[model samples]
Structure formats: C-alpha cells, structure tokens
Target: MRRSLIALSLAIVASTSLTAAARADIKSPVVIATEGAYAPWNLTDSAGKIVGFEPELIDYICKRAKLECTIVAQDWDGMIPGLIAGKSDVIMDAISITPEREQIIAFSNPYARTKAGFLTARDGKFAKADGTGSTLVTTPTLNNAADTLKSLRAKLSGASIGIQTGTVYAEFIEKNFGDIATIREYRTNDERNLDLENGRLDLAFEDTVVLMPTVEKANGALEFTGPAFGGTLFDAGSGFGFRKGDDELKAAFNAGIAAALADGTIKALGEKWLKADVSP
Candidate 1:
C-alpha cells in the first residue's frame, strides 16, 4: 500500500507539470499590425491608440482564441513587408483577398465584405450616373459589367478621378477608364479625400464603408455616386493578412473569426461602426 501511494503521487506531479507546460506554450502573445489611417476598419485616436472596427473585432478574437495579443500601427505600404520581416504576426487592415496577393501571403477567412464606389460633390456631374446607388458584382466575362463600364466611361469622360496609390482601385481605373478619365493617385486616402472636397478632383473612388462616414461628416456636401463595385478588382472582401507559411497562426485566427461570425459579433460591430452589416 505504501508503494502504491508513492506511485500515485508521482503520477499526479507529472500530470501537473505537463499541464503547466501546455499552458505556458499557449500564452505567448501575437503581435497584430494595422493601418491606423483607415477609418471604420482601423484608425488611431487622438491619444495615438489604435481603435475602430478591426481593433474591436481583433480584441474579441483574441479573447475567444485565448491569445495574448498586441496591436501596432503600420503604414499601409509597409504592412506586407513588415510581416515578412517578422515585425508583426498578423495584419487586420481590411485587406482584400485577391489572387495577386494570395501569391505572396496567406489570409484568414474573410470577416467582412464591402464594395467600392465613387464619392463626389453632391452637385457633381457623375452624381446621377446610370448605376448610382446600386451594387454591381463585376466579373471579366459578365456582359452587364462591360455595359456598366462603358456607361461609366462615357459619363466620367475627361473627369479627374482621384484614387489612393498602390490600391486595386487604381488598377481598376487604369484598366477600364484610363483612356477616358484623368487618373490622379495620392499616397493616402485623406489626401485624395481632401482633393475631392476642394473640388480639385471631380470624383474619388473608395470603399463604400469608408465613404459612408466621410459623407456623413461632410453633411450634404458629398455623396456616393456610380455603382458600388465588388468581386474581381475588389476581390472577395477583407481578411486578416498573414505570412505565407504561418499556418498555425492562420488557423487560430480562422477559428476565432468563424466563432465571431457565427455569434453575430462581427455584424454587430460593423453596424456600430459602419452603420451597415458588412459581415461575411
């Protein structure tokens, strides 16, 4: 009996040590990066703290995944490079998952989907264009897409269109309307928005989620014009960006995001921030 009792105690000690080791292994923090300039998705407060939809969503995700996480601000252009350089473990910047990007990095299951459209002054010529206030899911082989593009080209011909540099919006414009419209690229959305507001730009192409708040803040000065576009150039919504080989971290984020979407957490957050349900 004495021998059996000693053996049982030894077993208990080993089990406890193993459990502690597992717990320790699970407690390492993940560093997440975001472009703090994108409002409604991720933005910096006056105090320089990151806040907004993506940040709130990530907080819930971390809790659900039991992950210790820290979020850092990064320039939009440097997000991918920083991840490659090991500066961050995840990026939650409303990055659209496109084939071109898929070649370079992995992505979490998409958490939200939105569309791109034009924001112009209320009295702008394009305000009442044929497809205004409608959503268009465009594809390369779609007849309606070709028709819509042709109409938009004619309507916006010779107009100065502003877009942020190095974005899919630039790609779409240059591919479809480059010969028809004068394209101007800015390094930041704020710069393009300023140009649009000052009447230097006849139109500005941007994500509708971002444009909604801008229009509200502009009162009646600005409005979304032309058809809001999705698919193809816009890709299939936004997901968390990860390095190409980080399968473990990608799985963790996917599980957390799936739970959030299942529980309506993402939709609730979207409505609170964007005044729309952008959950995917």
Candidate 2:
C-alpha cells in the first residue's frame, strides 16, 4: 500500500507540473514594441503618451486577435534585438521589412507601402528631374546591390547628399555615389531635412509619406527629385516584426491586417494619417 501511495504522489506531481506548463503557454500575452521617436507612426506627445498611426492600428489588431496586449517604446536600433532576445513579442515601429532581417526575425503581412524620393530645394538644379511615383522599386540598380556607384555617380556628379546614418538609403548613397558626391550622415531625418533646407546638403532621400509632410511645411521650398525606390532598397511593404518561431503571432496579425484591408479600415487609417491609401 505504501509503495502504491509513493507512485501515486509522483504521478500527481507530474500531472501538476504538466498542467502548469500548459497554463504558462496559454496565458502568455502578446506584447508589441515601437520607437516613440517616429511621428505619425509612433511618437510621444506632450503628455508623454505614445500615440500615432501604429498605435491605432495595433489597438485595432489586438481587438481582432482577442489578444491581451501591451505597447512598449524602444529605440530603433534595439527593436530587432529586443525581439530576438525575447524582450518583446513584436515590433511595430515603422521598420521596413527587409530580407536581411528575416534571417533572424519574422514579419506580418505588409500594411503600408511607400516609395523613396530624394528631397531637394525647389530652386535646386535637380528639381525638375524628379520622377512621378514609386519609380525606384522598378528601377534596377545600375551596379551591384551593395554598390550602385555607376547609377548615382551621374546624377549626383559633384553634389552633396545627406542621409541619416544606419538607414538603407544612406547605404545606397554611400555605396553608389560616395566617390562622386559628398556624403554627409545625420543623426535623424529631421536634422537631415533641416540641412537640406539650410543649403547644407544638396539632396536628401526619404519616404514619400514623410517627404510630402515636410515639403508641405516648407511651402514649395523642398522638392523631391529622381525616381523613388522600392523593392530592394525599400521593400514589398512595411509590417510588424516578430521573433523567430512566432509564426502563430505573425499569422494572427496578418489575418487582422487582411481584414483591415478588406473592410477598408487600413485605407481609412492611411487617409487619416497620410491623407492617402498605401495599404496592400
């Protein structure tokens, strides 16, 4: 009888431990991260509240997913690492999903599409050379993907280009036109755009969404020229980044985004923030 009791206690302990493990897995909630510095996407207001398009989108997605969610702000450089290290469940900070990042992380279906455009002064020499829209995606790099020197050397010639360091656009400019044009790196987009306005940099490359707002504020002073790039330098679209093996979470968000697109919620949000539709 004593031997039978010992076996029964062990079985009970094992059952309890298994139950606890299952509960842990089932109770884990999804947590999203974002960079508060990016405005209209994610930014901190005067009251220290993080608000923007991403916030609105995520809130709506959480409702759809039936997820108990929390949003945390992290610096852009650390957003991916945070996910890999399990510091956060996902990243919603307007980060463009690229092939390089997918090796270690996962992303939801792209919810926003944007084109790259070079912003220059309206009075600048390159003003009239700008293309219509989303030209860069289809425009193949004249040289290597890592180095487009041949393509940019002609347009830049002896000009100066300003880009925020650590940005893909900066990588494009330096790899391609470093030898031809003077390359200046800034700490932020606002700083680089300011320099373009101050005559410090001959050109600046930014997303059309951000560029239009700046150009509007500049009142015809800042102009975008050249073909806006997508695909390689840009991407298929922008989406929330998740940790590797989080395919379940990724799929959930993708479904929510799809629903948003189908019902026109995505377009409505884009129109609300960007005054345009970029959902795809």
Candidate 3:
C-alpha cells in the first residue's frame, strides 16, 4: 500500500507538470503579419513601427481576446505562404474575404467593409467618363449591371490600367477589363501609383478609401473615375487570415472583432483613420 501511494503521487505530479506545460504553450504570443505598405490599413511608420487602422484595431482585439500578439511587416505577396509555413499566425492586411481565398485559408468574420474604384489623371480622357455616384453590388455575378458594365467597357477600353498584385481589386480589373484593356500588376500600391503619375499608365484601380488620400494629395493632378463597386466581389470587407486548421485562433479573433464592433471601437477608429464607418 505504501509503494502504491508513492507511485500514485508521482503520477499526479507528472500529470500536473504536463498540464502546466500545455497551458504555457497556449500562452505563447500570436504572430500577426501585415503588408505594412497599405496606408490607412497597415503601414510602416517613419519610426519603423507598423501603425494604421488595422494595427490599432488589432491591438484592441488582441487585448479583448486576452491574446498576446506581435505585429510584423511582410511583403504582400508572401502573406499566405508565410502563414502556412508558420512564420506568422495571422494576416490583418485588409484581406477581402472571397470564395477563391476561402479555398486556401480561413478568414475570421469580417471586421470592416469598403468599396473599390478607379483613379486617373485629372486631364486624362478616362476622367471624362461618367460615374453613377452610387455603389453597384457585384457579388455572385455582375449581371445586375450588365448595361453599366458595357458602358464602362466602352469608356475604358484599351486603357493601360495599373493595380497592386494579389488584391481583390486586381482580380476585379482583370476579370472585367482584361479583354478590353491592358492590365499591369505591381508588387505595391506606391509602385503602381508612381507609374500612373508618370503617365506610364492611364489609370489605377484600388480601394476608394485608400485612393481618396492619393487624390487629395494629388492637388488636382488625379481624380476618381466611374462608380465605386461593392458587394462580395469588391467589398465583402476585410478579415483576419489564418491557416484553415487554426480554428482556435480564428475563434479568438472573431470574438475580439465582435466585441470591438459591439462597443463602437471599430467605428471610432475607422472615423479617426478612414473618415468613415467601416465596421461591418
């Protein structure tokens, strides 16, 4: 009986140690990856720190979720591959939730929503095209606006368009205007904007909230053309990306997002940074 009691106590201690180690593992800090180049979403500040709407939002989300997290800058092209390889755990770079992306990775419930539009030189011919001044939903298909699409095609036909690669805006432009226009993909928005500014490209397409700053700064040199587009195709909103198997991480972020939205934290931050209520 004495030997058996000693063995039982040893077993209990071993089990307790194992449980403590597991808890410690759970406490490890989550690593979040962002493009750090997209302004008003995520950008690398002059101090070499990543700062912007998404960063601030994530800070609140992490705290609410009781998640210890570290935000890191990453190239836009490598976000998914890095997440898959375990170099990062979460992606918060304004990734639009799309059916195509859903097949490869999981997305937390959307936190913010915005529309896409086209920008061109103020004096460019494309600038003369008419805009609907209202959003057109393009989820599932563009059938709702067949005539509008046709008109836009005729207006923008043969124009050289620039867009950041790996973005939903790029996919939209390619699918809608690929046949009618010359589409050029850049690794970053600044690169594409530079080409457009230098007359190397006729137009650029991107998130309207993102392009608005460029237009305002252009001081009459650039302007938005055509109506902004929404719906799942263009504005399903932005969400945090994770490996499909990381359900725990996704759940934590979903909860955090929900809490933030409920308390108006998201709306307040959106107004401060984007000048609009982007909360979904």
Candidate 4:
C-alpha cells in the first residue's frame, strides 16, 4: 500500500510538471516585426517607441490570444526574409495578402481593406489622370477598366514613376506601366515621396489610405490621381503574416483578429488612426 501511494504521488507530480511546461510554451514571448517607419500604420515616435495603428491593434490581439508579444522595428525589405530566418515570429506591417506572398508564408484573415492609387503633383500633367474615383479590380479580369487603363497608359507614357521595392504595387506597375514609364524603385516611401515632391518623379503609386496623410502634409502640392486598385490583384486585404508552418501562432492571431473585428475594436481604431473605415 505504501509503495503504491508513493508511485501515485510521483505520477501526479510528473503530470503537473508537464502541464506547466506546456503552459510556458504557450505563454512564451512572441517577437512581432514591423516596418516602424510606415507612418500611421506602424511608426517609431521621436522617443523611439513603436506606436501606430498596427502596434495598437496587435496589442489587443496579443491580449485576446494570451500571447506575450514584443514588437521590433524591421526594414520593409527584410520583413519576410527575417521572419523565415527565425529573426521574428510574426509580421504585422500593412502586408497585403497576394498569391506570390502566400507561396512563401501563411497569413491570418485580413484585418483591413484598402485600395491603391497614384499620388502626383497637383498641377502636374498627370494630375487629372483618367478614371478618378473609380474602382478597378485586376483579378479575374481587367475588363472593367479596359478603356480607363488604356487612357492612363497613354497619358503617363515615358513618365517617371516611383514605387517602393518588394511591394505588390511594384508587380502591378511593372506589368502595366513598366514598359511605358521609367520605373524607379526606392527602399522607403519617404524616399520615393521626396523625389516625387521635388518634381524628379512624375507619379507615385501606393495605398490611397496610406497616402492620405501624405497628401494632407503636402498641403497644396500633392493629390491622388486615377482610379483605386483592389481585388485579387491586391489580394483580400492586409493581414498578419506568419511562417509557413507556424500553425499554432497563426491560429491564435486569427482568433484574436476575428474577435477584434466582431467586437468593433478594429473599426474604432481604424477611424481613430486612419480616419477611414478600413475594416476588412
């Protein structure tokens, strides 16, 4: 009887230790990478703190998911490569979900939906490019804007356009305008905007929501031109990116994202930060 009791006690202790180990694994710190320079999405304050829409959104997500998350600044170019190399466990920048990117990494359900457009000098020749305020979805087909696309191509022919490197917009611009326009790629949007503002570039293509703040800051110098682009060409929307096999983490984040959407946390935050309804 005494031996049996001792054995039972040992078994209980081992089970408790295993339970604790599993809990520790679940509660371990998750490193989240972001392009901290992307203003209003995730930017570094003058005090070196990462504060913006994404960081705040992730804060709610980490809480709901019971994750201990730490956000760190990463260059836009290295975001995916660094994640795959184990430098970060998650990416929450405004990364669009495209088929090309899905081939490399998995993504959580989209949290925000936005459209891309062109930003040019308000008085420039391309200032009033075709199809302004119209919407175009490039997936499935481009039939909707066949005429508008043609007009834009003709109007911007031989123009200099600036695009950030490693973006879905790069692919779109290259496929459609690459043959006609002089494509200049930059490592950051601020760099690209500098050239555009200084009249070195004829146009800049980016998310209209993201460019809204830039236009506001540009005062009377800049404005959006042409129709907004979306659909599968831009993918569903912006989502949390994860490694190909990080199922557990991805599931946790997806659940949190769903909850945030359902609870209107994402919607409220979008209005607060972006001043637009970006909820996906």
On lDDT, the candidate that comes out on top is 4
Cα error, candidate 2, residue 152 (Å): 5.8
For residues 1-280, could you state the per-residue lDDT of candidate 2 as single tens digits? 0000111111111001111112123234565667665666776777666777787887778777666666766666666666777766878766766776677678888999766667888887757563433364443343333233344456668888887666666666677678888898876677887888888888887677766667888888987776666654555578898877777778778988989999998899888887778776
TM-scores for all candidates: the values are 0.88, 0.80, 0.88, 0.89
**lDDT digits (tens) for residues 1-280 of candidate 1:** 0000111111111001111112133435577777788997887787777778988888777776667777776667777777777776787778878888888789999998888898889987778788888899866445568888878889999999998777877887888889998999887788888888888889999888887777887899998877888765467678998888788778878998899889999889999988889977
**Which of candidates 2 and 4 is the stronger one according to lDDT?**
4
Colliding pairs, model 4? none
| Stretches of model 3 off by over 4 angstroms after superposition | 1-27
How does candidate 4 fare on TM-score? 0.89
Candidate 1 Cα misplacement greater than 4 A, ranges:
1-27, 140-142, 231-233
- Stretches of candidate 4 exceeding 4 Å from the true structure: 1-23, 137-140
Task: List all candidate RMSDs to the true structure.
Answer: 12.6, 12.1, 11.7, 11.8
Model 2: lowest-lDDT 10 consecutive positions: 1-10
Off by over 4 Å in 2: 1-29, 130-152, 231-233
How does each model score on lDDT? 0.76, 0.68, 0.77, 0.78
- Cα lDDT of model 4 by residue, 107-155, tens digit: 9999998888999999988888877777776763666767877999998
